[model samples]
Target: MKALPSSSGSSGEKEASSSLVIALGSSLGATCPSEPPMKARRSLEPVLLAPWGSCLLALGAPASRPTRKSDSFLWPFGMTTALNRGCWHKSLAMMATAIKLAVRALVEVEVRRKSERLALSEAVAELGIRDVRAIGLAHRLVLETLKRLNLLDEVAKAALAGEGSLEDLGARARAFLRLFAYRAVVEGASRRELASFVLSAREALGKGTLRPIERALGRCTTLSLDDVLASRSGDERLALELCVPTWLLRLLCRDLGRQVAIGLLKASLVQAPSYVRVNTLRGEEGEILASLEQEGIVLEPVEGLRHVYKVVEAGKPIILTDAYKEGLVYPQDKASCLAVEVANPRPGQVVLDVCAAPGAKTTYMAQLMGNRGLIISIDFSRRRLGAWRKLVARMGVKVAFPILADARFQLPTRLRADVVLLDLPCTSTGAFAKTPSAKWRLGPRSPKNMAKVQARILRASAEHVKPGGVLIYTTCSLLVEENERVVEDFLRANPDFELERPEPFLGLPGLRGLSKAQRLYPHIHECDGYFIAKLRRES
Candidate 1:
């Protein structure tokens, strides 16, 4: 919904940046295929990714990354100066290998035009780097770097005065600089430590012919984040501190109040807890818990919901374990589980899932329905729907049938359903912690533009809700334009629909007196920022 951010490249360079964004959803993955990929590009444009399944996947979910207790994950604001088990590796051999390969991986990642996302963990896993820690180290390096990218660029541009601009550099050079900035600013690496990592870039950036890169690296070491902040105040300082765009941060401060907005932004930097719902379709709840416990996944039951639990820690990456393969557990955020609970579909009912893909909510809905109801899942991308179908099949969902259709226009069928779930695409403002790249991908007008798309989808979806049936509208966004405003526009046009209280309301009341709608914040709820409203067709 937002245009990709890039330097003022040539027409060709602009197209290439746009192309890579369309081809790949994240540096690790791609969502939709809106444009063809070109082999070279320095900038990236993010497409409308299927946010259902990989809600946390894009954020990260390889067990090797290691997290903290209570799903209140304590990811460091910046990595440590030297080697630690979690940050850079102590072994020079491993650090050199990780740095060399990571730089190459990042450069290639910029130009790749894949149809689906390749998780950084998975990408590193494929690099023939035989060591497990090396792969994990590379993923952390890239992931944290991308999260702080905006701030990195701000500091970089200033440090680059008279040295040349990041936009003017080649893709490899730009990628290396971003990596170097992450180490310097985020990790607070020393001159000696920075030098160690810089040496590895020679192998990735033209094999010892990187005089320009080396010269720039010298400037990067002298840059201090504090020095960068000294000249700014208000949201300007907070923007760099949080590594979010000043525009978005300004909007949040205005809407949520400065302190509340700052708290939310700060929480996003710390990875939220990974949550999973026990698939009752595969086995009884007790048996599934026992199985997960046997596999060393320590889970704490989340209050106010059934079947959803916070994954405190896991012995191994949950996906790699038999439980996931067997579809006994689903990796989901607790806030996502809350949206599904509010929908509360029943057995034998006909449900329409608009923009459903990658099948997180569809599968969960089927699990609650006892696989007895019919769910017609509609999504724009055939690729995403195919993914949904496969996921449902794995999760033992027999009632879901996928249909390829866009929700922005009229439907292809005349069927009205007992429930209509429109978890349509939005700015993904709420899930920024999970996918930090999204923060930079958006523009000032992005939310207002996305609200238009959400409004259209909501109008079309409401038509399919039978009289007295419920239409559950939800988005992983905090912006009112995409949530409350869209709902307000729909309610004004369609007088028959009225907001109803969502059950087990765990979040704060929605703004503008839409108390029937609930809002969840990462700072307060320890979950993704999300909005949920269940509307009843009152005719």
Candidate 2:
């Protein structure tokens, strides 16, 4: 092992001497001869009296090994002066213990929450762990465990057959078991590797508390995921295979054809590529591209879009890059950029962004408007609008004002705008690749419930559009109820507004005779699944 950097000459010498003592003790224990050559005895003297000698003694090295001024000691193990093997193993074990504890803590919090699901990022922030690498590993473990939660539960059930159901296990115990089973079955960890992880879990969660799981872990390793997937058929089989809920799979099949639905489901299992829009407020396209490239972030311009680029390679997290910190680039998805493009807000138009928070589309619209137009951004939650304020400020957007109001009821201001953007909340089925947790959180009634909310917001937003002004409705959802159905109902009730083809026509035509509207699918677009429709108030 490489010696750690020392503070000064004296400390360096001491560390070297201490390392030597540890090496000698490991090679020759208490049975070492009492007398040695004069040179060896003097060399070993300072090491024997050093503080590290106590550590060697504690690690099962004979207590007398450090006390004796030995001369006749035999270097049976070649007197290697590297770090002790047992100490290295113990250090690794401690690291694993910390990670398991962090994962368990996050999982427990998520499981216990009733109304609000704690985001992984928020959970990780609360951990207060100082080690960046360990935090990243724990974050990855939590995500993987949650992504395959249903499958893990099934595996755990089979493993715990005749013992107790997975529901009977306590939250912490269930978290630990899900994590372990994911590694053992999905990751294909060996029985011995899993046993070590379980031992670490036992130390963190108490041996008695983890006893039932310890017995079940052996059975967990013996099970095959293929067998579990093979047991189900059709939608059930697809759900297990893709780690999606059966209800979601059936819904997708009903909306999109079976082949297309399966494709979307499979695509959701993979991580989506990062896409960003150059902040024209700060720099020109060429300037931002050159700046990001200098930072080792190469971006490919998205086809048919000017400002949007797919991050081909980012040396680090793109958000942390100097280009990003300087507010030269805003990470917005390609499909999302398509909606703002279709809206085509001019430099001096008044745009109202209903349901604007965490302001991706709002900022993008501001960028397109050349920071010269008035944008009234409104959302129901003040907390989310606070984030919008930060994003607007970061992007140097001066023309946008944020309002805290529920768009479903009415707009905060009486002023009608040239363009009204209603990006309503709905079942986020399209963006599942990026947000797997949302898949399990949604239920059968989610689309219908969300459609009702979307319809109210759409009708309220329609009242805010000026004569002949465009009302752009969009959502990151593939469900027809939230997309086509909502728009169809809105147009039926309001004769003045009619659906028109979104400009720069990117994405496939919408379903249910709403062909003028556009839909982007994850499998086809290589971006989040999304829907965009442009309606003109003819009056």
Candidate 3:
């Protein structure tokens, strides 16, 4: 068989060359269809049942034996069939193109938003991307770019030094350049792949749109991220190297000490461990574990926490398994589970969950209560509360009621509770590994501003706690302003609440004499940076 042409004179030519190389690499030496190549190609066009399958086979390649996994290439578009060699290569090309376009669109929109932002889930849904694999890949690329934004910008600035600042580029151009830089520097994509990516981007974004950084993209391939960082000094160098803002670094250093802060920052750059809590209301832990093991999902019980396990390995996404569909388990972090355990809602008790949405804590509380308690889950967003309702139903939680109201304001009704849970919103520095975009969205004033809100909510929610009842405060944030300071201010003003050690304590003591509270760091705990304080209201 003749090899595909390799000369790249236009965007289409480059794309063809790239696709041919991918086909030659992945499909050439593995297996070939038993049928003749021509006959197989003709059959695949109609039989493959995917919009891109025929286009892929039409590009011309040898036939190969089909497999179930290969068929999943068309799964996103409602096609499920074994693909011949030619269609497989074309599927790769089409999926790659789709991912590139999706990433470009998402990054452009985010960059244009300035300080305001859209959640990645919202962006993915808005794009209406039907391919699961494409959605996953595009989401990964978007996060990688955002997580390493500072480093990517530094590299772009160095490569395009005399050209112009990244801020000066058009939104589309900036997005493309950042994506290219991440692929080139971080992913180490081949020169050929990089060239193909750039050409495809030009075609999609318009030739004139990418004109400004065309030369810079070429220069980015030659630059080294380490060399860029070595040129800076102190926190600035650390910030650029870790792809975090200098202000955030300084904040961590000042609050947690330079050594501890550096460790936390470095840990935050990597992926956090996945954990799931077995739904005791649905089944026993032993039974659930046996069922999950039958499905090839391995989990190890987290030390000190009942019903929570760290995912050792699952052949696929844990959420897709039958056990998950049956609501035998809920995907949650160990640190988060620790907070609910500290709250320790008892059967027949009245519990108020403030700012509870998506109901991870609320459902867990219901489980601990044996579904025999009155639990009111409150949040400011009606949309999020709707999701909370679904979660409640899915988890077999019958004792929880969803309320749409801000916890920072007065309660909707005069309903004091035996236990009040306040998981307030803050800078979310502790969860950077899981939600990297939050790091970029935050500014120096964010912690201070968020502290005020936390304090207000803490005060208002405290009213819902009956005298002598427990009030648990939690945040997925490491900042002292949001964690200890707010609690301290509330304690000083209220005078009726006294800090108490959270039972089944697992994390280290809180900062600045708030030793009774528990604090979890990503590096230290192998979980999200979290803070939990249990206080009892005194009459």
Candidate 4:
């Protein structure tokens, strides 16, 4: 096998720093707002020696002084090496090897399991007790690699030049090839950067494990986007250029029209805006704004929505701030906030939050209800409820009571509520700007399949809405199958419910004559793609 090219001395530091932010920011988004030069959080985060643990330190989280619990909230942050390059717990040689191995192992596991969340959990578990700054770096690396995986895999098949298929390669080799290809082809890593990666992988994974793909990496680095696109055309060409799936691209074109679909597809390539709902329950908005401002967190209020603000800039990742940790604000999408506002739950009303785990909406409903209503939070996953418990506690949501049960069937609750909020699951095509990996996991039939589940949950949730009460159905999906069609089918069977305009309508009118419903697009709103339908029971 051909060996990796030798590393050159680091030159053009100015160009490298500016390009680093733009390259890594593709999927890591608001994690680093413009990636201004900054330091690691003041305290030294524990840098464990696990393979992935070492990788976590690759981005310059000081491997020095032990951090206190109060100082140790791990969250994704800017991965600029300029931050902690001087304070590594180990030698650069070792950290480089750790980085290579960590990416390979995580990518391999993610490919095998088909779940980025699970893959991250395994890596984090192996990390032991360290600040997960490096883990966050690793996660961002994996996400970007995965986000552009469709394009990477297509180029790989061509780069092999028929000697072998990607499927024939060993899983670890496949993982390594994809990771480096992403760095070189997509992010345009320098020869020094690519050489360091190869040498590091050789040391960590052994030359034997990566030997099969060395030549492929060499071939891949020489190829251009046009070279990869030469053999493809039309939907296929656009899909490759956009790094989206062929079938999904066709669907978006058909549903959203070619121009609008292209706009939405292009939006997924860049960072999405991050938003937070100020929890007025904990403190007044004015005082909270001053505190966040003092901490170097900047904000711009979203018009038409009370207590919601777009993060204009931040000194660090929002989740790491004292305001976020204290639960003074909730990181929620603007589309999500619009749904809660549409529901407009009143104080003292009984509301059932179906499938409400990790409680952004549930907590927001409490905020609107002024903590006076009873919100019965229902979800099937015990693990999710556990998280929901912590989130609700942090948000100071006193009105919500959790129950573990599937909303697809009859809910366990016997009492009816004045409001039933169904933030049902979907293919998540609209939220791709934030979670681009989800688009790859979906299939052509994925929407219809999810629609079936959503239909069941909606019917069950509709069972709990009292007469004259409101039933709000929402999804982070632009497809009609999951939104208007489901609502249309529900209305056909249950004539007692009539569609009503959501106050402060923020999106386009729904399709198929469901004009009362609303649809929000990322291209139009600069937010997650969403569909919201409100039905008032007339019985």
- Candidate 3 lDDT over 39-144, as tens digits, reads 1011111111222223223323222435544332322223232464346545555545554544554564465432112333444345554454444445445545
Q: Which digits, one per residue and each the tens of the lDDT, describe model 2 over residues 75-100? A: 11112212232332343355464445
Each model's TM-score?
Answer: 0.80, 0.80, 0.81, 0.82
Candidate 4: stretches off by over 4 Å: 1-114, 129-133
Every candidate's CA RMSD: 11.7, 15.7, 12.8, 11.5
Local accuracy by lDDT, each model? 0.68, 0.67, 0.69, 0.70
**Candidate with the greatest TM-score versus the true structure:** 4
Better of 1 and 4 by lDDT: 4
**TM-score, prediction 1:** 0.80
Give lDDT tens digits, candidate 1, residues 1-539.
Answer: 21111222111111112222211222112111111121122211111022312312322322233343323222222223222244432344566666655665565545652111233433444565555444445555655666677777876776576678778877767777788777665556544355445544543445443545554555555656766677889877778888799999989877778898888887776546677889999999999899889988889999999999987766655665688778898777888889888999999999999877767889999998999979999877654555676678889999999877767889888989999998767777887766665676578998898888888888888888999899999888898888888889889888999999999799999998899999999989989998999999985
On a 0 to 100 scale, what is the lDDT of residue 490 in model 3? Answer: 85
Model 3 segments beyond 4 Å from truth?
Answer: 1-84, 91-105, 108-119, 199-209
- Comparing 1 with 2 on lDDT, the higher-scoring candidate is 1
- Clash pairs of candidate 4? 56-134, 56-135
Instruction: Give the Cα error of residue 187 in candidate 1, in Å.
Output: 1.4
